[model samples]
Target: MKTAICYYSRHHGNTLRVIEAMAEAGDAELIDVTARSAVRLEDYDRVGFASGIYGFEFHRAVADFARKYLPQGKPVFLVYTYGGAKGAGAKAVAKIAEERGCPVLGEFGCRGFDTFGPFKLAGGIAKGHPDALDLEDARKFYRSLG
Candidate 1:
């Protein structure tokens, strides 16, 4: 499959670990959405939108990018990392993709190191997360997709 994963992983880079393992295990393009504003998805047979959850959603830019530009009628999947089960963001973004005619594949998530807002007071949460086991699970998840 010609696939691409567009992601945003700031802070502790916990989310990056998962995708890097996944990318290394599979054949796919990994795009860090935070570093660029525009992306071309035309060549991909499958596309993924990944992010770190913020306030029950993905980074605003990621959500907006999916809502605004994710190609219609394509197969799209989701990946996320969060401090808690707050990625109600996935549902919102999935709905947007579905409305645009993108077929929903599935979703995957794992806890990432979080220090946003109040959590920052404690140094961090889920430190060293998206660790070896998490990365292995992510690799399994990608293999399962086939």
Candidate 2:
């Protein structure tokens, strides 16, 4: 399937690592949501939103992109990395996709190195995460979408 993953990977690039593995395994296109404002995804067979959880949600930019640019009736999927525990990041985006009549195919979440806010004082949480196994799992998740 021709897929495009719109992503925001900041701080430690934890989400980026998983995204890269999924792209390599699935041969999908990557869209950096932070860099682009207008993206056309009509040509893609499936669309994905990926990001590290920020304040228990997908990064604001990513969610905004999905709200503004995601195509109607398209197949959608989610990928996210979190520090302490999995949050509502996936659900937040899925709701947006659903509003556009898109079908949510699946979602994948994993621990990612985090140093945001108070966690920074303790050096960080989920350090050395989105590791080899996590990347492999992300790849497998993407493959299963087909």
Superposed on all Cα atoms, the candidates' RMSDs to the truth, in angstroms, are 1.5, 1.1
Best by lDDT: 2
lDDT of 1 at 41: 85
Estimated TM-score for each candidate? 0.91, 0.95
- For model 1, residues 24-121, the per-residue Cα lDDT tens digits are 88988988876777777878998888888878887877777777668879799888898866648688778888798988888889988888888899
lDDT of 2 by residue, 11-127 (tens): 798998999999989789999998986889998999999999988889888988988888889999999999986657777888898889999999899999999888999999998
Q: Model 1 residue 62 lDDT?
A: 75
Summing lDDT over every window of 10 consecutive residues in candidate 1, give the lowest-scoring window. 84-93
The superposed Cα distance between candidate 2 and the true structure at residue 84, in angstroms, equals 0.6
Off by over 4 Å in 2: none
